[model samples]
Target: MNLNESDMKVQEPRLWSSDGWTARVVKNEDDDGWAVAMTPDGASEPALVGPWTMGRDKKNPKPLDQSAFLTLVKTAREFVRRSEQQLHAALHQSIAVTVGTARVTVCLDITPDEDNPSATLSARDEGDDLLAQVRVPPSFKLSRSSAVAWAEGGFVKPR
Candidate 1:
């Protein structure tokens, strides 16, 4: 179905609706350029704020056409999926850290050795050089800030 300017136009800047998310290209508050915001349905605020770059770089953002709208929806949906996956990874799967001169990767891994579960923490250099191995207990803990900092330059001296 084709969506014309009259059909897409709304009285107000849509925050979000239960049906789905909405976004509009407008002048950036920080820059004179344009940007598109992705706000999920019923959301009070935008979830992702990115500069609209897929359209023809003309004076005006190319109208949201059928093909373009479908592409936009697919793109936005994929972004949401990736975001969810990253959140899940941060919560359950694995993490790689970057300390000043070191990188540490930690993860909860379950192998065929079900009789012996393990949490492995492998430290490496920025050039992907293996530094050391630390066998953590099954009850290992991790957080985003801690992981980021540890990856940035946080490490304990091996004694």
Candidate 2:
């Protein structure tokens, strides 16, 4: 069966919903006040969790409202964005170095895996020609000096 966007049912607001995000009020483990957790779809955990305001009785947590839900969506989206940026910075690093008469870009890309972790250090010329590539340990550090040294030393694996 093929399902289109129009055929999809509109998600109802609840303590937990399956739309792009779900806002749920849960008992705070560290304190007596309740906390609201905003979880993005397909994520294992909530992107944002914070203290929730009390309801009229001053006991039960306030119900989720349109205003609060919109704010939570913005906050959760930003959280996901920042997380992706940090992960990208950790995985891919690059440096520019002069190799003889030509300037080359050296990149260190790390592929993390549970069974086996690996990294590739590659150099490319001005026109994007592959100059050299070497399989290195994931923990190998890449710097301008290191890249220049490797290129000058005949592109051998650096110690």
Candidate 3:
């Protein structure tokens, strides 16, 4: 009863766990077909869930094998990695523009909240010195023209 997760991993006909990932074959609630779920260790929900192959009998799901389990782990890992990259891109964005004789990096950081979303627009010089920052609308569009205009206008909060 005091064993750790390594000793409790289960590799059965419909389930497999290894390499910090688990693959489970379950009945698809939406239809008669079976489905496979790939969940990372310590995760509450699966990162990937899709259709599963049927057994020869066509009634049961195909038994999970080493090959299938490895494939599922690879796919699920990729899915999680891409999801993280997308979220980073959405929450933090930056662009470089020429402000007179100096180069400036404009950054937009968005904090998403159900009650009220917020965003901050900031600028940094080529030496990574904070030049100016202002609060902006969450819907503010960050583009080259907007960044140039902001710097040209003395870093004022854009209306």
> Best candidate per lDDT, number?
3
Which should have the higher TM-score, number 1 or number 2? 2
lDDT of 2 at 120: 97
Top TM-score: which candidate number?
Answer: 3
Q: By the lDDT metric, which is better: model 2 or model 3?
A: 3
Cα-based RMSD of candidate 3: 2.1
Query: Which candidate, 1 or 3, has the higher lDDT?
Result: 3
What TM-score goes with each of the models? 0.43, 0.81, 0.87
Model 2, range 108-142, lDDT digits (tens) per residue?
99999999999999999999999899999999999
Candidate 1's TM-score = 0.43
After superposing candidate 1, which stretches have Cα over 4 Å from the reference?
A: 1-19, 53-58, 94-159
Clashing residue pairs in candidate 3 (N, C-alpha, C atoms within 3 angstroms): none
Candidate 2 regions off by >4 Å?
1-18, 56-58
State how far residue 125 of model 1 sits from its true place (Å).
Answer: 31
TM-score of model 3 (CA atoms): 0.87
Residues 54-140 of candidate 1: C-alpha lDDT, one tens digit per residue = 336565554444444445556777888998887566445556755555556644442324687665655555566766556555555
Compute the lDDT of residue 5 as modeled in candidate 2: 38
